[model samples]
Structures are given as structure tokens and as C-alpha cells.
Target: MRYGTLDWVPALDRPDLLAAPVTEALASWAQAAPDAVRQVLVAEIDPDQADTADMTATYDLPLEASANCVLVAGKRTGEERIAAAVVRATTRADVNSAVKKLLDVRKASFLPMDRAVADSQMEYGGITPIGLPAGYRVLLDTRTSAGPAIIGSGIRGSKILLPGEVLAELPGAEIVAGLATEIAA
Candidate 1:
């Protein structure tokens, strides 16, 4: 299948395009929602263009069609709470308010890049909600699940394309309205 000038193949058919954990989680997704998982596709790309901005420019993909996943964490009474915030590239996650409130933490901030990569076992620029730790919440902004989107494949060398419906159905996914603030033009 081709989407936005990129050749996309069923992710399950080409595990090499996904990170190890993404591959594993995708298998689980297949079992839970065969049809949805079947819609998930992957396309290899240059590692240097893995970030949302670069990917959009290089591939002629609309920023609004791209989903950016950010890892956020906060400490509450000695326990650590973490989540992956999935929002459109045209907006930023409301971590300071929506996410913090959701986690019931006094404060919330992006997890350090190194820690996020290590904890998620995914590349920094290619972090996606699909294969995060089971305990990590997947906070999917409502906008992301409203249409087709391009998201990380859990690695820097490829990207996944799927409908918003598929992302909304990920295990542990929580769709939140007002979860993001649109960026100014």
C-alpha cells in the first residue's frame, strides 16, 4: 500500500521495519484486533529524517497527519508515574495540565531522552505508543485518533502508517479530549 508518497507494507509482514518490542506488541495487537492490526503498515526511511519535522518535509507528508509520541514522567509520593503522550505534530501535548492531572501528580515533564529511550527500549526520535512498558499509560490525544496518521515504528529507520482508529485501540490507550494545544502558525 502507498500512503503520502511512501510505500507501506503490512507491519506484521516485515518485522525488520519495526523495533523488537514493536514487533512483539504488534503480534499481541493482531490477536486482540486482527483487522486493525492488519491495517498497520510500515515504510523504511532514512534514520536522519526520523523526527516528525524532517519526515514531513522529506516525504511530503502533512504535519497534521503525523503523530508524535512523547514520554512524560512525574514522581508522586515516592512512586513514579510515566506515560506516552500521542498527539498530532501540529500540536503539543498538554503535559503541564492535562497529563499531570491525569497522572494525579504535582508536576509532570518530559522524561529525559536517554531515560525515555532506555525505558521504552526504542530510539529517542522514533518512540511510539505501541510498545511501551505495560505499566506506562498511553495517553492518546483525541485528535490523533480521528484520521489517518504516520507514527514511529519504534525505530529510527522506519515509520508506521495506520488509521486513527487503530491507534485508539492500542492496549492501555486512553483517548483524552483537550489533551493537546495546537501550535501557532
Candidate 2:
């Protein structure tokens, strides 16, 4: 398989390309949802271009086909809540409104980069929803639920491409209609 002109292989067959947790997650997902998991494909990339804008341009990919997995957190009654919000690159997560409300917190903000990386055990620019901590909610934007999408592979040297609908089936994922606001692209 291929996406953006890059060769892709079954993520389950190439554990070396995935972060450790991602490898485990994919294995479990594959067993439970083989049909969806079978469609997931991974491709190697230059770590330097792993960031979205750089990768999209360098690989000649459509922005609409790219997705970003943003980590956010807030506290409610002294209990901390974390969520991984996945939205299209053409839009931005509605962190201040939808997310704050969903979390039932007074405020929500991007999880600090250092902690996001350390806690998730994923590289800073490659934190993916596939392997997040069990406690973290996975909120997937409605607009990204039925098309092709390019997302992080839990490592800076590769990416995952799969149909958007599959994300909705990920463990603990919820499809939220107003989760993101469109941005000028």
C-alpha cells in the first residue's frame, strides 16, 4: 500500500517502525478489529519532516488528508482529566470550548510538551491516539470520521495512513461533531 507516494506496510508486521506501546496497541486492535486494523498502513519518513506542514509539502499531500492528534488536559474537582483530540489539519481542536466542556473543567490547555512525550511514551511530534494511556479519552472529530487520513505512527520516522472511520472504533474513542473549528487553509 502507499500514501503520498511513500511505500507502506502492515504496521503489525513492522513493529520496529512503531513505538513500543503502539506496537502493543496495534496487536490488540488487530485481534479485536481485524477488518479495520488490516487497512492501517505505515511508511517510513525522514524524522526532520515528521511535523505536518513540512511533511505535507515535501510529500505533496493534500492538507485535507492530514490529521493531528492533540493532547489536552484539565482538572475538575482536583482530579486531572486528559484527552487525545484528533482533528483534521484543516481545522483546529476546539480546546477552549468543546473540549473544556467535555472535560467539565474550567479550563483546558495543551498538555505540556515534555510531559506529553514522557507520559505517553511517544516521541514529541509523534504522539498518536493508538497507544495513549488507558485513562485518556480519545475524542475524534466528526469531520475526520470517513475519509483517508495521515496521522502519526508514534515515532518521528514514520506515519500511518488509514480510513478515518477506523479511528472511531479505537478503544475509548468518541466521535464529537463540534470538536473542531475550521481554519483558513
Candidate 2 lDDT, tens digit per residue, 1-185?
65676888988888888999999999998888999899888988899999999989988778899899999999999999999999999999999999999999999999999999999999988889998988999999998888988889999999898889887788888999999999964
lDDT of each: 0.92, 0.91
> Alpha carbon lDDT of residue 28, candidate 1?
88
RMSD of every prediction: 0.7, 0.8
Error of 2 at 43 (Å): 0.3
What lDDT score is found at residue 123 in candidate 2? 97
Residue 89's lDDT in candidate 1: 94
lDDT of 2 at 136: 97
TM-score of 2: 0.98
Q: How does candidate 1 score on lDDT? A: 0.92
Error (Å) of candidate 2 at residue 105 is 0.3
Error of 1 at 124 (Å): 0.9
Candidate 1: tens digits of C-alpha lDDT, residues 1-185: 87777899999999988989999999988987999999999999999999888899998889889999999999999999999899999999999999999999999999999899899899889899998988999999999997898999989999999999888988889999999999989
